[model samples]
Target: MASSLATLIVSSSFFVSFILVLQLSSFPSCRADVGTAASYSAPYLPSACYGREATEFPSSNLFAAAGDGIWDNGAACGRQYLVRCISAAQPRTCIPDQSIQIKIVDYAPTATTLVLSDKAFGSLANTSAALINIEFQQV
Candidate 1:
């Protein structure tokens, strides 16, 4: 009887552990399904150094400044997002499959504008344009 009880406990524990892992693994897929895609004509910031401290960013850094509504103060720092160019001033300005991931490193106020690094903007669309439309979702 003692051996059987131990076996049952081990089995129950294993079942529960499997269920927990399955649930955790589904979180990313669930979030992607529920995430709302937003479009914006974000302006490009020539310099990546943003915020009061003017923290310098690496040349290859793909980052953006979140607008006030979505900006959680500095909480947005290091949050990753997937950005896709939806439209541009010129035809075929955006490269195919050019959707790039960017990290939030600063704030852009309540105004409807996202300030991206020059490299990030240039990769998505014609950098000469004052603004470029893009679809983005938080990852």
Candidate 2:
């Protein structure tokens, strides 16, 4: 019985490890895969003061949530980046020369995606889009 129990435990451990590997493989690789962004409104961020770390939300009306990997221990917090719409999925649009300056206020720890506030997103892309491909550089 002890031998049988040991075998069962070993099998379970192997199965769990295999599953973890499969799950991680399905996640997007961290690289310059062309970042994307989605807009969030006041409803998603109820408080204007709700940010990773800021004495008070800035009055510029521009802010975003850095992606999980890019957040980098809050190194991006309060940092301004210039974001521009590069391209969009069909049935959507991308305006050349469309750009906006945004400050990082939250974390988006989910690969190559930035979560922008409605005001910030709207400044560059169509407000109705669920997502938009973008290129950003620290400014």
Candidate 3:
């Protein structure tokens, strides 16, 4: 009876671990990096990358202005990133299970990480908050 109990326990442990892995795999990220983001209001024209062109903004208005870290001497333009709000000064500000794919539209020296469009920022967090720590991965 003892041996059977041990065997069952081991099997259950393995099953639980397998389920956990499967659940993690189902998450949106394959690999992600941590950072911070701030919101930016309109007049998104004359972008450093696209130069006042309508193409600078995505149809969904989900876009970001790359900061120093990813500027890559202007190569960051048009790059897309998957960004999610992980935390903030007020953790409750973050929307649950929310993430957005944002395109890089310009360069921003003032942002801690990147400057997200109002719509993009609102998707991951409440508009009332100015900033949020984030998990991001270039896609």
Each prediction's Cα lDDT score?
0.65, 0.75, 0.91
Query: What is the C-alpha lDDT profile of model 1 across 1-139, one tens digit per residue?
Result: 9999999999999999999999888785433211112233434343223544444444466777776656765677677788877776677766678888887766666454466777777777766665666677778
Top candidate (lDDT): 3
Q: Can you write out model 2's per-residue Cα lDDT over 1-139, one digit (the tens) per residue?
A: 9999999999999999999999989984543336888877764343323633344466777888888756877787777877888887755566669777888777766765688888888887777787888987776
Estimated TM-score for each candidate: 0.56, 0.63, 0.77
Sort all candidates by TM-score, best to worst.
3, 2, 1
Estimate, for each residue in 11-109, the C-alpha lDDT of model 3 and write its tens digit.
Answer: 999999999999988885567889889989889988999998985588999999999888998999999999999999985999989989999999999
TM-score, prediction 1: 0.56
Error of 1 at 35 (Å): 13
Task: Assess candidate 2 and give its TM-score to the true structure.
Answer: 0.63
Cα RMSD of all models vs. native, in order, equals 6.6, 11.9, 6.0
How big is the positional error of residue 128 in model 1, measured in Å on the Cα after superposition? 1.1
Give the poorly placed runs of model 1, Cα more than 4 Å off: 1-59
* Candidate 2 wrong stretches, greater than 4 Å: 1-33, 43-55
